[model samples]
Target: MKVHFILHSFNASCMDHNTLKFCVFLILVGLLVNISFAKNDFENCKRVVKVWADSSLDKEIGEDNHKLRDLLFFLHIPRTGGRTYFQCFLKKLYPGYLECPRSYDKLRFDPRKKKCRLLVTHDDYSMISKLPRQRTSVVTILRDPIDRVFSTYEFSIEVAARFLVHPNLTSVTQMTKRLRSKTKGISTLDIWPWKYLVPWMREDLFARRDARYSRGLNTTESNDSYDMEDFAMPLKEYINHPASGDIVHNGATFQVAGLTNNSYIAEAHEVRHCVQKYKILGKFVLQVAKKRLDDMLYVGLTEDHRESATMFANVVGAQVISQLNAANSSLDIGDKIEQRSFPDSDPHSSEHQNSTSDRGASKVTSSESGETAELNITVGELMNSYEGCISNLRTSYSGRRIASLKRISPVNFSREARLQVSEEVLQEIRSLNDLDIELYEYARAIFYRQHKTTLQTFTEERWNNIPSIVYGITLWKVLPLAITCVFLLFLFLVIVNVRRRTLKIKMKVMKS
Candidate 1:
């Protein structure tokens, strides 16, 4: 009986051991399952960790339903935050879902049509509207107009000077003059390529006289053929054709076209245009685009005015939500954006510059690979990504400006530059030396003319109407002249008094 009890006791001990081992095995299996699920469910997009990635963090923040995959109609301005949004946020998060092709064609993310998900491009609002309902969500970023303008101008100057073999686009003066020959140097003028491109490409605007095939033609001959149904229109007629001008002016609002010449007119015209274009269907969208446009379309933007941009993004709804959420959450993503960035000095670094402007496929492959690994970023890299997005959105359409300035690299300014830049500006301005037209008036007129307004109109309205200093001197020129005259008068008085005293002293000595 005692032996029987001992065997039973041993059996009981074995049973307990087996029970413990089973529990341990189950726990291990559970952990592996959880890890696998985490890997599949959570995605690192735009180098930004989403709010839903960590359950504990999500619980703390009270964020739910984080996987509301949105349709993004990203209004990507060249240097704006679009690239960062695409590279770091959208690509990884959506994977094959987001339709942002690395090209100049507007992306369409059609889930059902797996042919091509992302459409890479440099298209405007009209194209953005074509995106599918479920696959596309629209959002855009804007910069302060003044800063945007300057950046666009600088970047255009940089790019043209760097990669493209530009002919006659030598200096800022030459750029302005060349642009003026076709269209004024308006604010939105930088966005229109046909004006400068057709001339620069030297593709005889008279080459193709096919109207039916003129959908995207940038020349008059192409349009004339369509209208005439025959190519009998004079070359000069075709050259100065409205269709050619329309190619430059189409899609651009009147204000954008007129901005370089008239702020008031440009603003008024653009505001009116926004009202007319979006009045039928895109009321909310137009309002958002216009509100954002006001910030970048008129003058330009500076770096400090970035907050206004954030707020601007918020008004556009769902698309902005992802951008904003990504921006806010990425603060903890390690050092992505650093102050001492090597990318700043080396424009060749894909991290800071967009590769779409010049070098083609090889450059794109290298560039994509560089930023592809940004999913594991530090805070510095995230910030850099954010700034890069803003830069791209602003400068995307201004490729000529990019080509002109060589924004990515330092260009050698040799007299051997290809563009045929002229020496003089105009005949009237050069002949105005005799009027001593208030230098202010002359300056204002010059600026106004560039903005697309006539000098006579600007002078009559603003400067000419001002009470002239009867001596016809501008305050800028007059102030210096007045100071000189006062000094000369004082010197003459001092010299005459000294001479009289000396003469009196000599006479007294003679009498003595």
Candidate 2:
């Protein structure tokens, strides 16, 4: 009522007020709106003080304390230190046989058939529907959306540039069927949404660099030899491009809510389907995202690698790692650790297996500065380039190891440098990722609140001795002797007590 009255009064006063008075009135209205939004923002996310208060326990395979049996789903947002978390921590904490095959290009995960305990994937929140009815807890890591966007742009450019330089950039085909394959191989450049954005970036960047050369920037440089990292388009151009809609705009919110502008999933249309999937979450996206965040067991931040890792070890690790001892007792856990550090690994894959069928089928023709050239992309070249892109991505990304997260390190392994953007571009990025910004802030606050009362951070001693202390593992050679000695000592003490009791009874009888 108060706001209504104030607004009505402003409406009336606006007709008679001078310019100065009108400006003051507008300022007052702005303050009112800001205050209301501030309150709503606070109300959206509950201030969580306890971390494990909501962690549910379950009985699975005769194990009552196995809370992780309730589906340890890791909602891995791209470029969010996810590789480090999975490679360094999750693999160490759980056996490989327990991890679900990754569902990247495809979205089919059946826990009932697979009987997998851990789920780590890049699928969106829509994955909840595809999953069968079961108890699951979602955990994820968030980044400052601005930094995430820049990293994404940087990584895309890096991948595209490599594709441009590769010998198989245009000439490779006859790819074998990999239906059940976990390697998410992208076979074409005309895929929906943001997949094509990579090729678009490639073309734009080539044009951008060629223009520089024409202006006599580096005429002395070789025609064929060049740095692979030099073709990244300018920050403003990359973010503002028409192709960046789905991939760049409020990605965190979209991933969290699993929302698409459809009454149903994958609805087809003549024209709408052809248009790229628009990814900026609409009104109430944050509300849905915040509720989803609140429902999660934990939401980690990319920036707070140490604190996040420690909190996860203390909170989530106790649920899963506490049960690994029985599985790895005779087996060396160090040997059971992650053998495959990266996701794009497949030994059975062959490059030249079907080259005869696709010798000159799929080729890309690109022209720059009125010079034309046709480059063929065979299946071998495409797979090889994709694999190299993965390698380059690995070089660019570095996450803290679980064992080393507790300690500080001086060496920096990340090839991705801190990017600088113009003020206008920064503001534009902020505008585009506003929802993610708010969501990240709420997650950060909850993280601190959850850890505010905990005293000890996860230590290396605990990491090394997890099986022994938590999983009840004993030394293989000494366990039997220790058990026998305990039994013998108990037997001897029982005999001595019985003898003393008999002696007491006889003495009492003689005295009587």
Candidate 3:
């Protein structure tokens, strides 16, 4: 009996030890899971904050009306630092107010009836005009027309090369040579102009439905909830037709090539009928169909006085950067740090991968001419540029038109405002010193260059009550750990209960 008792005691001790080991294993697993989740969340949060560091985040800048509603238009110029800005602003201030559409078409269609605080896309003014922008701030960044064209070309070639579409043209120089080549047998697919122009010509720019000629366009049907980064397609397809330009099909679509008697042509167009419309007839014919189609004449922020352009840019940057800094600071992105360093420069190579360097190099340069030609953009410019243009039309752009003057007040954007915006954010942007001094040069270069500019003079009244939009990475990270702990705790309790019950049964058997 003593020997049997000793054996039973040893067995029980061994069982208890095994049970303890199992519980410890569960706990270890739980901790690992939790830590994994927390780390993921932390990274996500940092990503969100980093996005705002880009100057492009101001794409969603707007004001809340007395009705307590948000209204803003999003300008998504891909690879234009727009992603970072939108993500940061949405995460920090806008929260539920903004939507980033993967493709411009789906975003427009889905939100046709829905009023939103912010709507951003690579879409054109025509598509955005359909949105309720009566009280919203409509804004977009324009790159130097030449650089914009260059980027579009480069991006297209990269896509084409990936699919092995163009064999002879592997690099930009080679592609340029191939493009300029007068080969008679060259297929439209083999050349740039043909490939770029085919879709535009094939598609009925005026037709609401997709044309059979353009059947080779973006093969994917519209998806309401597509994410841009995850989207993929053949390189040939992306460049052949951009979805942003697809807004031509929407109700407010601008007919770039329409044959109507009454038409508004973009200032960029050189057609006799078009130039006559703006310069001669002055009828205010709608060319770029947008929310305020009649009002959007390319206006220079200042009367051909060059200094105003620089000041305007700084003000815009200051406003945007200040808000972004506050937003970046509010997030508790648990402990990951961003790798903040400029990329190395590559001078010998034609196409380099350093995003920062590429951005720096693309700043606008003046043509041989000393002054840049003004586009008929802002009404403020119309009033200032041509004598008696605004008074003759008796028209006013919808926004609070900064009065027409050769020189704008530089005093408004104070030094204090610039200091409030983070120097770190400013570090990301290409400095204005590298760009042409003209308004168009600065505007276009700033828009295209990939960098973060600080907004030192942001108005507290605009974003006062808004909570920083945090990336949900922390919740994602900690959730795993929490789940593991809870699961382990539950398992431990169950084990204890089972052991007690088993012991009670054994004792009863022994007594019996």
TM-score for all models, in order of appearance = 0.29, 0.53, 0.28
Candidate 1 local lDDT, 1-512, one digit each (tens): 43345445545655777676555555565566666654553322211222111321221212221222234444454443444444443333232312333322212223343323334333444443345534443344333332232233233334333323333234444665765576322222233332243333222212222342366633333222113222222222432444423222212222221221122221333333333333232132223334323322112122324432332222222233444346435643232222111121111223223222232111111123222122233333334444565466456545544454342223222224212222221122222111112221332333333334333444666666566545576689978899999999999999999999999999999999
Name the top lDDT candidate. Answer: 2
Model 3 root mean square deviation, Cα atoms:
36.6
* Residue pair clashes in candidate 2: 170-376, 170-377, 171-376, 171-377, 171-378, 172-377, 172-378, 172-379, 173-378, 173-379
Q: Pairing residues by index, what is the TM-score of model 3?
A: 0.28
Model 2 vs truth, CA RMSD: 18.0
Question: Candidate 1: lDDT of 300?
Answer: 17
Candidates in descending TM-score order: 2, 1, 3
- Comparison by lDDT, 1 against 3, better one: 1
Please name the candidate that would achieve the greatest TM-score relative to the true structure: 2
lDDT of 3 by residue, 118-200 (tens): 55544444343355545544444333332333234333333332322222223434765664474322232332222443333
List lDDT for all candidates, in order: 0.35, 0.52, 0.33
Ranked candidates (lDDT, high to low): 2, 1, 3
* lDDT minimum window of 10 residues, candidate 2: 49-58
Q: Write the per-residue lDDT of candidate 2 for residues 126-200, one digit (tens) a residue.
A: 676555425566788999898888767755555455443323323311121333245434432322223566667
